[model samples]
Structures are given as C-alpha cells and as structure tokens.
Target: MLGLGAPELILIILAILLLFGYKKLPDASRSLGRSLRIFKGEMKGMKDDDVRSKDPARTTPVRGEIVAPADPAAELEAEARAAELRAAELRAQAERSRTADGPR
Candidate 1:
C-alpha cells in the first residue's frame, strides 16, 4: 500500500517465507490477523470515546470531585498492587502457621 509494486511485494513475501518456513506461515498469519483485529477494535473504541466526550452530558461534572477515567493501564497497575498485597498476606499467614506448628 505504501507504493510498493508487485515485484517488491513478491520479494517481501519470499523473505518472510524463508525466515519462518512454510509450516509456521499459517500460525504467523493467524497471529497477525488477530493482532490487526484487536488493533482495529481498540481504535474504534477510542474514536467512540472521543465522540462521547464531546457531548456535555457524557463528561464528568467539572465542579464535583474528579472521577477517574477508565484507563486500562491504571486498572492493571491497581490489580498488580492488589495481587502483591494478597501475596504478602498469604506469606505472612503461612509463616504464622509454621511457627504455631512448632518446628516440624
């Protein structure tokens, strides 16, 4: 699509085939297709969010306490912190139980 002609396309395809071999091509193609689908979906979601944010009713009230946006990165970071806290609690509980069991 970036101005590459048929010969260039053929050469690129040949390079990919040589690098990954025939057997792995299908799996690689499926993976690429899935990635493209996910990318498209996320792009559409962002576009929709942009549309919604332009409307006054859809946005958070400015005077009230600031509401957190639905950010995936922040959610993942919070989940990771929760998991770490849970792990630490479990380790402490295990240590307490071992000590209570008296040196087995």
Candidate 2:
C-alpha cells in the first residue's frame, strides 16, 4: 500500500514503534481503533440517512429539531462504553506520569 515495499513498510513500522515506544503503543492503537469505529458508524449512518431521504414517505425534520437515535438503549450502552474507555485511558496516563516522575 502507498507504494511502500515490504522492507520500507517494516522500516516505517519500526520507526513508529521506536517513536511511541512499546509501552504506549497499545493505548495509541486502542484510541485509533475507537476513532475508526466511530468514523465507520458515522459513514454508515450517513448512507442510511441518504437512503431515508430518497424515500417518498419519510419526512425530514425541521432545522434545530432534535433527532433521537433509533435505539436509545444501544446509544446509552455505547456512551457507557466510551466513558469506560476514557476512564481507562486517564488511569493509564496517570500511571505513566507517576512512573516518569520517579521518587520526587
């Protein structure tokens, strides 16, 4: 991908690993994954909205009107999961800072 050969890709991967270090890599990856998931969901929702707009029976809401999610329980669960991820990230960050401070 991106015109990078195997060796070049390996070198780039190694550079990223060294830059971030092994300890923080997982956290970075987890955040990236969450971001990708959110983006993917948004894209899917946009496509669904496009399809809905094309339908003759469905009326679009007026501007400034609130839109509720199709599944409120699922929305709440996703929010709870996000909060958990944020909390975990904060704890990891605090631990990293504490270790880096070292006997001060």
TM-score per candidate: 0.52, 0.55
- Cα lDDT tens digits, model 1, 52-87, are 899976876679667776688999999999999999
Give lDDT: candidate 1, residue 96: 96
Candidate 2, superposed: residue stretches over 4 Å from native = 61-104
lDDT of each: 0.93, 0.92
In candidate 1, position 76 carries an lDDT of 94
lDDT of 1: 0.93
Which candidate number has the best TM-score? 2
What does candidate 2's lDDT look like per residue over 1-104, in tens digits? 38989899899999999999999999999999999999999999999989989996565768997767678999999999999999999999999999999977
